[model samples]
Target: MTSAPADSVDALIEAEFDKLDLNHDGRLDWADYEILIDRYRKTAGVNEDDRRIQELRAFYQLHWLELLRHSGAAGDSLSRNEFVEATRRTTGDTNRLDAAKVGGHVIFDLVDADGDGSISRDELGRYLQGVWQIDQSDPRYDFDALDTNKDGVISRDEFVTGIQEVLHA
Candidate 1:
């Protein structure tokens, strides 16, 4: 397979960073991520004790810590450049493809609402609409593309592989 252009990978990284920034402040902080988790929980009707909810929270926390560790910043926030650098370090790759894969996995875990190791169309649509603010008209979140196996559901591997393909194309 042909590798994606560097510009494409950079754009994907930037888009993912912008989506997580939430406040349009060009930085990611606890407050922004907290809002994200809370919003998803409320929209998805996930209870506090739900294992998926807990896992989401835990994973987000772990990712944040990893970012901070890589950035070596004293502040609780990560600028876009810092975020990119951290992702690169975390993925241990000079190319951004691995970072995109890691981000895709994180996104898969977040959107898989039922903790069943796959994402239903409903779960993906809800996440797109509620969290990513993408309307149904936006083909970016279409189930056909995400459900790479034509199974009507998106497994974690499918989701990550699909994302990688998109980013690398």
Candidate 2:
């Protein structure tokens, strides 16, 4: 896809860096990343374990490379327009109802454990694993872990909270 102007991408990248640069140092560093992660997970009320933290770091590395290669000049950060485009590609577009419909379908499919038109815990755990690209030779343990009430099915609220917890965690 054709990208935004160089200045545009630079602006976007700077904004992202500012947002992620919690220390307000005008640059991103590992120390800033730790603060970001802790705050993000705390807001989501989730705790990311070490493995997931590593995974997130790897993903960010890939993202940084992509932005730098596509929309950034050497040693140049991304502009806001370019950053928005890049993020949209990674997170899917929010401007279209069709996209939202598809997103819901994905979540719904993940939660339909019995294929009976309703979401259950088993389906939910699998969905989270899939969303996070987690490897599961058998099945996910999220259902067992988050199903505090031990009900046969996890409510919609539980499903959302569980995924958010794991994602930020």
Candidate 3:
């Protein structure tokens, strides 16, 4: 499959970083991650006691640590440029951290609100609306793109593969 251009990849990363930088301080820290976890919790309608919420928190902790470790920044937080570079390296280094696998699983688990091991279009819509805050009216976020098998739901494999493609694209 053809990959996205380097500039496009950078743009994607930047866009993600901007989303994650909750405070708009141009840096990423534990606080930012905590806010992200909270968003997921609220979006999934799971309390902090929920296992899925706990797993999401753990995933964010690990992901944050990995980013900080690879960031090479002097402070505990990562600057915009540091975050972009670290994400590129961390996502690319599957040997150390299979981001698509680990992250995808956690995200899929959270998005699968019915605990049915699959994501229905409605579930995905809730996630997109609550977490990503995407407009439900947008057609570009159609489930068909990720539901490769077209089985009416997004399986774990399909979700993971979609994330992998985006990361590597």
**Each model's TM-score?**
0.76, 0.35, 0.93
Per residue, candidate 2 scores C-alpha lDDT tens digits across 1-169 of: 3445656645644555666656665554456656755543443234576444444444455545554554444454544455555544433323322222333443443345455755665455455454333343334345555555677776655555554433222
Candidate 1 per-residue lDDT, tens place, 12-65, comes to: 667779888888888999888888888777867767886666766776777677
Candidate 2 similarity to native, TM-score: 0.35
- In candidate 3, position 69 carries an lDDT of 81
Candidate 1: worst-modelled 10 consecutive residues by lDDT: 91-100
What digit string (tens of lDDT, one per residue) describes model 3 on residues 1-169?
8988888888888888888888779888999888888889999887999988888888788888888888888788988789889988888877767877898998999999988999998998998888877765676467889899989999999999898889888
Residue 94 displacement in candidate 1 (angstroms):
13
- Superposing every Cα of model 3 onto the true structure, what RMSD results? 1.5
- The candidate that wins on lDDT is 3
- Model 3: clashing residue pairs? none
Query: Can you tell me which runs of candidate 3 are displaced by over 4 Å?
Result: 136-140
